[model samples]
Target: MVGGGFAGLWAVRALKSAPVRITLVDRGNHHLFQPLLYQVATAGLSAPDIAAPLRQILRRQKNVVVRMATVSTIDADAKTLELDCDGGNETLAFDYLLLATGATHAYFGNERWAAHAPGLKTLDDALDLRRKLLLAFERAESETDPDARDAWLSFGIIGGGPTGVELAGTLAEIARHTLQGEFRNIDPSRARVRLIEAGPRVLASFPEDLSEKARKQLERLGVEVSTGTPVKDITADGYRLGETFVPAKTIVWAAGVSASPLGECLGVPLDKAGRVPVEPDLTVPGHPDIFVAGDLATLKQANGKPVPGVAPAAKQMGKHVAKAIRARLKGVGIAPFRYRDFGNLATIGRMAAVVDLGAWKFSGIVAWWFWLLAHLFFLIGFRNRSVVLLNWSVAYWTHQRAARIILGGDDTRC
Candidate 1:
């Protein structure tokens, strides 16, 4: 198993009672709850609240061994993997290989923009962003020049996806409510928060009406939502919003993502996004012993639409691959994999969200509550759920975020 994410972890857990021995390898030591990652980036929750150590999680299972290393090379014909660790490089042999390696941010050919606008994908990214955000306010408070101070107070989020929406909404709340009356020279409520999307509407994957509702909800939170506005260039000073250059100190890139380059190592033709077009059974073409799941694999449903890369789909794919492996050991053929659409949910701001469950669709405070509960239920471990629930409760009632401390040594110069 390659990756400690939802796909790899679920696959490992599902194979606990099986006859085969397993080795789970990943570079990161902890399994992160990515859906709530934005909360950590926005100071709503701490890092540990959404992450669990891998060894601790798999301690009870005796059939599995966890290795902390990066898989550098995969020789499919020899069924050997080259692992790079702190000590040295080593080759490990495997009977069956599962590549659940996840994805990273895509700059869409403007790699230099990454230095100015960072994307939130991991714990480090979140912490760095939190520091940048808090320091932006602090820098603004101490600035002497009016235009420089305004630029320091300005913030821009470049994507309209779930992460972008959640970040923009929470940042607005922090400026207006959390940091209220904290600084004498500047009113934090006057900070400018902008959400820019090149597309025609936000949450393009959702129903049209829900997208409209989400836009309105963001606007109500004082977020300047700009749609159909493509970003031409991004620099330390600001970004080019279509034809005009907007000055902003902090910029977040949540626009696009590409699959891990490990897919190319498999020697298979990949899609435009660098994702492997897997077989119906979630196996790589011409290599039944090799499986790919999560954001790394791409599969089209009967309806001709690609399967969404949400947590549910990744978990299901992981379990399906595990089932296939078990059947293969018994010389029994399993049926083709089928994805069950479980609907979608996106939160805009406080007491605002949109839910689409096929025939049933809803938005507003009720949807927000539903979103909260659903995330709590899906979070791993009792302690995590408890801590997150408590933090959220405190923030909801007090309108103040709990984990607002900026620790990293990030550049906050205006």
Candidate 2:
């Protein structure tokens, strides 16, 4: 198995009962609960709360061997993978190939923007953002000039998707509540959070009404939502949306996403987004034994829409791949992969969220609780769920985020 995101992890988990021995290779040592990554960025939870050691998660399963390495090359003809394993290059052979390397945030032709605005995909990105955001407030507190202080207090978030919306809401809460009365010179409640989206509305994936509702919820929390505004440029100062220049010290890019470049090394035709084209059974074209799942594989559904790059879809792909592998071992053909639409949820602010479950759509406190329960149920480890619940419960009641410490970053500067 190549890669260790949700697709790879779930694939390995399902194959434990199969007759095959598994080797799960990944660069990281933990399986991160990606859905709750925004909480880690906003200081609502710690990193460990949303991540579990891979070794511990698979300790009971004796059939799985976890390797920490980066796959450098894939020779399809030889069915061998070259990896930078154990501080040296090693060639690992596999009978069947499963590529679940996943994807990274797309800068949309502006790769340099990554330095100015980091996207939240991994734990390191979250920590870097957390440090920048918290340091913004600290820097603002120490600034002598009002203009510079205001610039330090300002934040710009590019993208109005779930990740962007959640970030804007939580940052607003931190400014309006978490940091209130904490600084003498600066009123944290006055901090400005601007969410800029190139689209016509926020949460474009949801219904129009829910999108408007989410917009209102964000506005209620003091986040300035600017829709149909495309970012022209980004620098250390801030971003430019069309003709307007917005000054901000912190910026987050949650806009576009592209598949991992590992798909390129496979010597196969890929889509514009760098995703490997897959067959109905989630296998690469002309390579039945070589399966690709999750965000790395692009598969169009029967409805003519592409499979959404959510956690559920990735897990479904993983399970389907596992089934196909097991069927091959038993000399039976597996059916084509089918994705079940399980609805979508995006939190707005305190006790506010929007949920779209086909026709049974809802928003507000009920949706917020629903979102909480669903995430808790989907979290990988028991300890993670427990700690996250405890942290959220305390934050909900006290309006105080417990994980607000800024550690291991450059000192606060204006």
Candidate 3:
């Protein structure tokens, strides 16, 4: 087993009951709770609050071995996986392999702006964003020039998906409600949050009605939601969207993502997004001994729509692959992988959220509560659940964010 995101974790859990000797390899030792990463970026939660050590989580499972190493390549012809350890190189031979290597943020061919505008995908990214956001405010507090102050206070979020929407809304709340009276010179309440989307509507995966509702809710929160505007260029000064130039110091990219290059290493057929095209059983074509899952694999539904790259879908695929591997070992006929749609949920700040459960659809505060509970329940440890609940409760009652301390960096130029 390779990769240690949500999909990889679930795969290890499902394979616990099987007879295979599992060795989970990943670059990091901690498993991050990714959905709430925006909260971490916005200074609502700390890194340790949202991540769990992989070895600690699977210590009791003797069948699994956790290795911290970077995968160099996958030599399918030799049935060996090459890895780069801290001081040396190593290789592991396996009878069967599961490739759950995840995806990375796609810069839409403009990879140069990654350093200036970081994407929130890991705990490190979240902490860096937190530092940048807090430093911007700090710089704006003492900035004398009006133009510099305005640039420092303006935040730009690229994309209108759930991640982008959540980030924009949370930043709005932090600036307007949480930091309203923190500084004497700068009125943080006047901070601007602009959400840019090239598509006609935000949350294009949702229904038209829900997207409209989300737009209205975001507007109410003081977020400038701009649709049908594609960002042509991003620089340190700001970003260019067609004829308009928005001078924002802090720019976040939540727009696009591409699959890991493991498929390319294996010389397999990949989709437009660079995801490996997997068989119905979640195995690579012509290499049934190897499997792929999560955002790295492209699986289509009966309706011809590709399966979403959400955590639930990845977990489902992981479990299915584990089951197939077990059946193959037992000399039993394997069943085709089938996805169970459990609906989708997106929250807009504190008061509004949208949930679609196929036959049942919900919105508003009630839906927001449901969304909160579901995320808390899905989080890994009891400590994390308790701390997250406490954080939400305090934020709700006081309307103040606590984790706004900047770790390191100077934001005067930002």
Report the number of the highest-lDDT candidate. 1
Candidate 3 or 1, higher TM-score: 1
Compute each candidate's TM-score over C-alphas.
0.99, 0.98, 0.98
How do the residues 268-292 of candidate 2 rate in per-residue lDDT, one tens digit apiece?
A: 9999999998999998888778999
* Segments in model 1 whose C-alpha atoms lie over 4 Å from true places: 410-414
Clashing residue pairs in all predictions, respectively, total 0, 0, 0
What alpha-carbon RMSD in Å does predicted model 1 have with respect to the real structure? Answer: 1.1
Query: Tens-digit lDDT track for model 3 on 1-414?
Result: 998988888989998877879999999999888999999999898888889999989988889999999889888978999999997999999988999888989998899989778998888889999888888899889889999999999999999999999999999988889987779999998999999999999999888888998998899899999999799999999999898888989999999999987778878778878999888998889898999999999988888888899999998998888888888888897778878889889998977888888788878898899999999999998999999999999999988776977886544345
Q: Write the per-residue lDDT of candidate 1 for residues 108-133, one digit (tens) a residue.
A: 99999999999998999999999999
Error of 3 at 41 (Å): 0.3
Clashing pairs in 1: none
CA lDDT, candidate 1, residue 154: 95
Clashing pairs in 2: none
Consecutive 10-residue window with the lowest summed lDDT within model 2: 405-414
lDDT of model 3, residue 301:
88
